[model samples]
Target: MSRQFAILGLGYFGSTVARELKRHQNQVLGVDRDETRVDALSDMLDHAVIADLTDENALKELSLEAYDAVVIDVDDDLETSVICTLHVKELGAKEIWAKAHSDAHYKLLKRLGADRVIYPEYDVGVRVAESLNYHAMVDFIRLGERQFIVELVTTQRLVDNCASVANLSIDRDALFLVAIKRGQEVIRNPADDTPLQPDDSLILMGDLQALREIGRQI
Candidate 1:
């Protein structure tokens, strides 16, 4: 279903988000103080305009309450960032996602009623570092502070001698095998006797420490 959204900045991060939202068929209003940035993304968004988000009166004119959510991405200007967050909150925006550049900025955004605080650079850096550290890790999702669901390819070390799921000897308390992807086929709740191929993808869930241990071993 299509939803209404408003992006309150037009920098690299903001423009990228606006374009992706529009690509997913959402109605996006892209606002920015920079006319050049606004014009550059005008063709991609539902409405692109040059507006100063720091001015509550100017923001009120946008009728932010009507949009399903608003994203505040003026991280370059810390004061403007928090001010916009406050304005959107007061304007009755249902959901607010704000970018924070530092720990203090995150706390301020949270105290000011931002529904979610995003640290784009930190998020990307962590994912990249994890991929580099875990050679077999394909992707992963953090479920909580210490828990994660990871996808890993069966490495040569684990596939030796035509091993099967029964040969894994995984610690039940640490990790649970959820599924296996062999070529185009996906095996959910796979049997212990299921044959493991060298290139098969394993979907497993466990604590991060346990996952990291397995990642290092295979």
Candidate 2:
């Protein structure tokens, strides 16, 4: 289903979101203070406006209630981001997603009624560090503060598919397989009984330490 999305700020992060949302067949409205940026994305987005998102009164002039989702990617402008979120909520925006520069900013975003807060720099840095350390680890996602979901390439040295996995001695209560990515295709929500093939990438969600331990053996 298509969604109506409004993106405030046309900076790097906001522009990227706008493009992706449009690519997903969402009707996107992009607002930014920079004229050049507004012009740049004008052809891509359904509507592109050069406006100050910080101005609550001006923002009120916009039909915020019409958008199903609002994304505030205004980086470094904590005050503006907060005000925009608040005003958007007041205008009946169903979902609000914001970008945070730091812990304090993240807390403020939550207080301002942001449904989701993204720490792009911090998140990207962590993923990059994880991939650098583990050659088998393709990517990592945080499911909770203490838990992570990781995608890793399975070793090709296994004699038997089922036997190799059974010998791993994984604690089913604490850790388990979630999916198998064979080549470019991903198998959704795979079961433990699913046979592992050489060169298959397994996606596992569990405690970070447990994932690391499993990665070492694989």
Candidate 3:
């Protein structure tokens, strides 16, 4: 299935997203204020246009509502990003994902009606730190204040072959195996008898400290 997306702003962040979305077989429309940048991405994106997203009339003319998702990646101009986000929301876009330069920007974008806000710089730094320390930890997703869902490689010492709560002792305030990600297959709510493979990536959900302790033990 192919989803249509519109990317506002064609800076490094927006251009990268546009290219990747097109690579994944999605119809991507990239908008930018710079004609040179737009031309550079013309071959890479499904459609590339030079336009100012901050202008309500320009954004409305683009038919942004047609896109399943709209990504706002304007960092140089925060006001423009906020205006674009509001315009997209009012246009009835199914989803709008925006990028923020700081905490203030993030809050403003969220308030302006962006469905999701991403701080790429901060998020990348966190992921890089996790990857450097725990090579087995492939990814980390925030669940709550102190909770997280981590993707970790299963070890040989695990009692069971399948990822489940039976093999590992989880504290009352700690973590538990949520699922097993094996290759492209995901086994959710696996039974205790489920055998885990070393190649399997276990999706553990619970306290961050407990997950870290288990990772260290392995």
lDDT of 1 by residue, 1-218 (tens): 99999999988889899999999999999999999999999888889989998999999999999999999899479989988999899999999999999888998999999999998777778888998999788889888999999999988778884488887857779899999999999999899999898889999999888888778767
Error of 2 at 177 (Å): 0.9
Q: In terms of lDDT, which candidate is strongest? A: 1
Over 4 Å off, model 3: 131-135, 154-167, 172-174, 179-200
After superposition on all CA atoms, how large is the RMSD of candidate 3?
3.4
TM-score on alpha carbons, each prediction: 0.91, 0.88, 0.80
lDDT of 3 by residue, 1-218 (tens): 99999999988999999989899999999999999999999988888888888788888888988889899988668788888898889988889999999889999988888888999888999999987887788899997898889988877765343254566665646777788888899999877777767768878889878888877755
Model 2 poorest ten-residue lDDT run: 157-166
lDDT of 1: 0.90
Evaluation by lDDT, superior candidate among 1 and 2? 1
lDDT of 2: 0.83
lDDT tens digits by residue: candidate 2, 1-218:
99899999889999999999999999999999889999999999999998999787778777887889889988688788888888888888888889999989999889878899999888898888887887778888888987988988877654253444456556677787887788788887775456677788888889878888877766
Residue 174 shift from truth in candidate 3, angstroms: 4.7
Residue pairs with backbone atoms closer than 3 Å in model 1 (clashes): none
CA lDDT of 55 in candidate 1?
93
